[model samples]
Target chain A: MMSELDDDLVARAQHGDAAALEQLLGAVRVVAVRYCRARLGRTVGAFTTADDLAQEICLAVFHGLARVRGPLITYMYGIASHKVTDALRTAGRTAVLHSLDELEGRADISPGPEDAAVAAELSAQLARLLATLPPQHREIIVLRIMVGLPAEQVGAALNLSAANVRLIQHRALAQLRPVANEILSEVNP
Target chain B: MTAHHDQHTEPAEVQHDEHLAHKLATGQPGLPQDPLSILLAACRDDIRAAENPAMPLLANAAHVAVRGHRRRTLLAIAAATLVSGGAAAVVLARDAQPGSPLWPITELVYTEHADLALIRMALGDARAAITQGRYTDAQIHLDEAARLLTRITPGTPAQQLAAEIGTLRQELAAHLAAPAQQSEPASQTPGARAATPASAGGTTGAPTDPGSPGQRPATPTPGGQPPVPPGRDRPQPGEQQRTTTRGSSRPPR
Candidate 1:
C-alpha cells in the first residue's frame, strides 16, 4: 500500500537526501506517534513519553532506511512495534493496567476540559479495549483507525488481502463494543 | 457486527460489515480522530527546529551509510581483483557524485579523505561556520581541508576526495566574496539575525570616499539624516595619509 510519493521519498532517503529523509519522517510522524501511543496505552504518561518513543522510532527508521525491503509504513511499524512490545514486557513486571471491572471508573474525565481531551478519553478507553484483543487484531484496528491508513494499504503492509483486513477490523471493533457502547455514546460531536 | 459468530457471511451481512467497517476505520465512533496530535506536535517541533543535541546525527548517519557502502565496495573490488588476477573494473568512479555510486562511497570514504578524522572534523567545522555567516572561519577550515586534499596523490584512489575539496573551496570562496549571500545564512544560527544587520551595516556604509549609509548604525539619524559631522569623515579637509580598511571598518587595526 505504499503510495508513489512515499516510494519516491524512500528512494531519495536511501540515496542520502537528508532533507528528503527529514520530510519523509515528518510526513509519517503523526502515524508513528499514534501507533506508539496506542501500543503504550495507559503506560504512556507513566512508563514512557509517546513523543520520545515516536522520535526513537523515527531515528530507527531514518538510520535503517536502507534495510527497508517493503512499504515504508511496514518498516516503521515494525520498529515501533518492537520498541513498544519490549517496553510492555518491562511494564508488565512492575505495573498493572486496570482490570476490566475497574475500567469504568479509571477514566478521569474532567468536565471543563476541551472536547479534544474528551475525545482522547474516549480514544483511551478504546485503546484499553483494543489491548484486550490479540496482537494481530489490535494492529489492524490501530493502523486502520488511529493511523487512518486505507485497508488496502494496511493489507499491503500486513501482507493480508484487503478483504481480510476488513474482516479483522470488523472483528476487532466487535470486541471493543462493550467499552465503546458505554463511553463513546456520551462524547460530544 | 450482529455477532453472527461465523466470519463467512451472506451479501446482506457483508453489506453490514462494510458499513460497520467504514465506521470502524474512523475509530470507535466520536473518538476524535488523531488522539496523539498534541503530544506528537512537540516532538515534531523539536526535530524541525533542530533544538536537540542530536541535531548533527543525520550528517553522521550519512557518513555511516557511505562508510558501509565503502566497505562493501572495497570487499567487492578486492574479490574482483583476486578473481581477475589484479584486473578490475575502471578504478575511477569519478562519475559517482554524492548521489552517484563513486562519489559517496569512494570519494567520501574515511581512508580516501586525507588525515581521515581530521579532515572530517575540519569539514564539519567549515559547514557549521558557513551556516553561521562566519565565512572567514569557514575559509580557514576549508583551507585546512584543501591543504589535506593536496597531500593525497592526484592520480590515486583519493583523487576524487581532492576534487571534492576543490569544489568546497570554490563554494566557500563564493560565500566569502558575496556580501549578499553572507546575509542569508545569518538567520540560520541562533541570535544571528540580530548580528547579521550589525555586520552588514558595518560593511556596507563605512564611507567609501563619499557620504554613504550606516557609518554609525547604533547612533541616531536626526530628521532621518545621518549624524556625521560633514568634514570630519572625509580626511580632515586635506590631511594626507588617509586609508580605509580593506572591505571593512576601523582602518585595518
Candidate 2:
C-alpha cells in the first residue's frame, strides 16, 4: 500500500526534511482531492469546491504536521473528513438560502446540454445513489473505491478494523445494488 | 462491541457477503459487470477524471503550504541553534557521516545538503552502468541516487538531479524496450517449459528464501504514489477473497 512509502516520508518529515515534508503534502493533496471529489460529486462548482477544500486540507495538514503521531494518511483523512463535513454543511445552508432563486444556480447543479452524454449522466446518477447511503457507509465506499485505499488503510482512516471495513463495504454495496439496477432499468427502458 | 453485535446477528452470512462485496468493489477481471459494479467503477473513474485537471492547482497549494512551514521551521531551528551555541553543533556535524551512528542526527538537523555529492557520485555510477548495458547495476545506482535525493531540499539542484535521473531512466527504457519485445514471445514459451522443473526445484530447495520470491513481484511499483487497483491486491484480507472469486465455478463471461 502507498502508506508503506508514506510512513517513510513521515519519518523523514518528522526529522525536518523539507523535501520529504513537501512530498508528503503532495501525497496528502492527491488523497484529499480524490476524497473531496468523490464525496462532493458533480454538485455546482464541484471541481473548484473540491480543489479548494483539498487545498484547505493540505494547509491543515501542514500546520498540524508537528502534532500528528499516528499514520499520516489516517491523520490527513481525518482532517479531510472534517473539512468535507464543514463544506457539506455550508453547501446545505447555501442551498436553503438560494432555494428561492431557481433559474441561475439550477443550471450549475443540473446537467446542462454538454452534460447530456452517457458518462456524465451515469456519474450524476451514481453520485445521487452514493448520497443516499449512510455517511459512514458512503465514506467507507468512497475511500475504498474512489480514493483507492486498501481495506486496512480504509479501516485505519475510518477507525474500523480491516474485517469491519470489508463487512461494511459488502453491506453498503448490497444496499446500492438494487437501487443501481433500478436506475439502469429506467435508463434503458 | 457494535462489530461484535453485527457479527453475532449475521454470523454465517457476514464472511460470505464480505467476500462478495470485495469482489464487486475491486472489479475483479471477468466479473459480470453488475450495475453496482458498473456504478462503483464509474465512481472511481469520476475521481480519476477530476484528479488530472485539479492536480496542478492542488500541487501549487501544497507547495505554498510547505514553503510557509519551511520558513517558520528555519526560523525556529536558527533560534534553537543560536541558543544551543556552536561548539556542540560543530562536533555533531563532524561526527555525522554515512556509516557513523550519528548519521541520523544529520537528518534531524536538516543537513541533507551533505548528501548532494554522494548523490552525484551515485548518478555517475548509474550513467556508466547504463552505458555498459549493466541495467541492473544502473538500476541499483539509480535507486541509491534517488534515495539520497530525498534527503536534500527539493529545489533547483534536486530538480536538476531528477532530470538527469529521468534521462538515464529514458535511456534505460530505450535499451530494454527492444530486447524486451524480442524476448517477450520467446520468454513465454521457455517460461512455460521451465514452469514444471522450477516448481520441482522450488520444492527441493525449500531452504531457499520464500519471502524473497513473494517480495520480488512487489518491487516494481515506485515508492510514492497512492495504491493503484492492482496494488490493492496485496492486502492480506483482500487476497483470500480474490483467490476464492477467481477460482469460483461461476460461468465464464
Q: Candidate 1: interface RMSD in Å?
A: 11.2
Q: What is the lDDT of candidate 1?
A: 0.48
Using Cα atoms, each model's DockQ against the true complex is: 0.10, 0.17
lDDT of 2 by residue, A39-117 (tens): 7665442355566566666555655566678877788887898878888887898975534443453454444566535
Where is model 2 chain A poorest over a 10-residue stretch in terms of lDDT? A98-107
Native interface contacts retained, candidate 2: 0.27
If candidate 2 were superposed on the true structure by all CA atoms, what would the RMSD be?
18.6
lDDT tens per residue, model 1, A32-57: 65666666643322212344456556
**Cα lDDT of model 1 by residue, B131-229, tens digit:** 775444554566566655555556754565566566666565454334433334433654554454644445444322122221222332344322232
Which lDDT value does model 2 have at B158?
96
Q: In candidate 1, how many Å is residue B24 off?
A: 6.2
